[model samples]
Target: MVDDDDLILEVAQMSLEVVGGWEVTTANGARDGLVRARAEHPDAIVLDVMMPGMDGPTAAQALKADPETADIPIVLLTAKVQSADRDRFADLPVAGVLAKPFDPMRLPAELGSLLGWT
Candidate 1:
């Protein structure tokens, strides 16, 4: 998972670890997340939309544009839940989206369904 907010990261980590039973690696920013993604080649990525430098869309675009990482599933987490905002991501190679203030308890199942893992 990658997010600028420290609390979100911590909470997400705990939820995924304890409830989802998944070993998660987190990054504070897009750059670090990309680096880790390349190294770890994780099954999926949960990315925050708004960040200081590279936002989720841009990072996702970069990841998709790269042949090495293009196939990795990406899930965008955003506070922008507007219809238009959701439509804007239609063309991107994203696996799914989760609205902000999400239910941590259901996150793993939601992502798994999106990624077609279940």
Candidate 2:
């Protein structure tokens, strides 16, 4: 998982670990996320959209562009709720998008559903 916010990363990791029984690794920004993804080859990546430096879609594009991590499904988590905010991601290849302030209790299920992990 990748997000700039420490609290969000902690919450997401805790939620997924407890609720989904999954192991998680986190990155604070997109550049690290991309590098980590390539190295770890995780089952799926849950990325935050508004991160500094490389933003989620750009990172996702980079991951998709690379041969190593190209097939990993990416699910975006964003605070972008407006049509305009959301439309910016329409052209990206993402498994799904989940709104921010997401219920921590529901996050695991959401991730499982979005990535077909369940």
Candidate 3:
């Protein structure tokens, strides 16, 4: 997971781990997320849209550009629920978008559905 907010990171991590029963790792921002993603090679990445240093789409571009990280599925986490903002994300080759303030209990279902994971 990648998000600048500590609370959000913590909540998301717990949601994915506890409710989803999945192994979870976290990065504070986009740059670290890239470095860590390269090293860990997670099956999927949950990235925040607005962050310092590098935003989610920018980081996703870098990941898509690199052969090493290209295959991993990326799901954007965004507060921008407006149709225009959602349309913007649709242009990117991302798996899906999760609205901000997502429900912890529903995270697993949301992620699973997006990645087509049973």
- Among these predictions, the greatest lDDT belongs to 3
Compose the digit string of candidate 1's lDDT tens values, residues 1-118.
9999999999999988988899999999999999998898988899999999999999999888878788889999999989999999887789889888978999878778888987
RMSD of each: 0.9, 0.9, 0.6
Could you give candidate 2's per-residue lDDT for residues 1-118 as a string of tens digits? 9999999999999998988789999999999998899899999999899988889989999999999999999999999878997787888999999999999889999889888867
Predicted candidate 3 versus true structure: per-residue lDDT over 1-110, tens digit per residue: 99999999999999999999999999999999999999999999999999998999999999999999999999999999899999999988799999988999999899
Model 3 is weakest, by summed lDDT over 10 consecutive residues, at: 92-101
Relative to the unseen true structure, what is the C-alpha lDDT of residue 55 in candidate 2, on a scale of 0 to 100? 90
User: Scored by CA lDDT, what does every candidate get?
Assistant: 0.91, 0.91, 0.95
**Candidate 2: C-alpha lDDT:** 0.91
Predicted candidate 2, C-alpha RMSD? 0.9
lDDT for model 3 comes to: 0.95
The TM-score of predicted model 2 comes to 0.95
The better-scoring model by lDDT among 1 and 2 is: 2
lDDT of 1: 0.91
Clashes by residue pair, model 2: none
By lDDT, rank the candidates, best first.
3, 2, 1
State the displacement of the C-alpha of residue 62, model 3, in Å, after optimal TM-score superposition: 0.5
